[model samples]
Target: MKFCYACGSPLIMKDLEHEGEVAYCEQCRQYRFPIYHSAVSMVVLNPNEDKILMIQQYGKKDNILVAGYINQKESAEEALKREMKEEIGRSILKQRFMRSEYFPKTNTLIWNFAVVIDSEDLSQVSDWEVDKAQWFSFEEAITQVKPDSLAQRFLNNFLQEYKIKSKDFFA
Candidate 1:
């Protein structure tokens, strides 16, 4: 920041007392302001219990799940639903908040959700943002996509949760 928000004085860079990071205004005793971005992701499962919906990225051509940024006046859940509709043209059945993580390296807060959808409703998938949409078994999805994608992470978590929930229900 060039000017201090609290006081309209020009900011000067200097080392902070406790933290090594540089401060914005040393004379006015102001610290540097950090900005964070919000992102939303969805883990969508099919009714057949055999496949998960994945989108082939238009830019990278790699398979990924439904995810996007939260708009100016949108909630995390709303953003996920909007992204799903815009990318795949399908409506989600049931959704539950899964987990959230902050990536300091990217200054992004990622909100993830697990959603269940009917397999028969994949007829009107969109191709504007995504090149193609396909359903893959858990094992096939994990092995086929890029290792560091959000889809892989969601699949791993979904599998773990599914196993635990199924075991508890059965036992």
Candidate 2:
């Protein structure tokens, strides 16, 4: 940040004894404010129980789940629904909490949910934020996308939980 919000003075990067790395303002005698980003993502599953719906990013073309940033006055659930409609043009039937991960270094928090949708047809999908939508099997999805990405991590966790639940149901 160029100017301090509290006193409107210029900010400078300085090594702080207690805080380690910080932006300090000489006039305000305080550290610069930090910014945080909040995002929502959904792991949309079809009714077949064999495949998961994913989007091929327009710019990246990487296999990723439906996701987007939360707007100024929108809730996480609202953001997820809006993103789904904007990206894929489908209505989500139900959404269940999956997990949340925070990247302190990047100041980003990703809230993930597992959503149940009607089908995997992508003919009506929108090409706004996403280029196309496709269904990928659990094994294929893990092998195709970046291993360290939030989408992959969520998929892995979901698969484990799904398998356990299935086994319990059968037993």
Instruction: Compare the candidates by lDDT and give the number of the best one.
Output: 2
List lDDT for all candidates, in order.
0.74, 0.79
| lDDT, candidate 2, at 145 | 61
| Candidate 1 lDDT, 1-171, residue by residue in tens | 477767778877677778765648655786867557899877677755567777777677787777888888899978877887887777777777777877666678889887777454666777677777788787887787568866677668877887678434212
The sequence of per-residue lDDT tens digits that candidate 2 reaches over residues 1-171 is: 678878888899888887787989999788885767888988887766678888877678688888888898989999988888888778887777778998676677889888877667777787667786788887887787656787889888888777778534212
Which ten contiguous residues of candidate 2 have the minimum total lDDT?
A: 162-171
- Whole-structure CA lDDT of model 2: 0.79
Best TM-score among the predictions, by candidate number: 2
Candidate 2 ranges beyond 4 A from true positions: 1-34, 104-106, 166-171
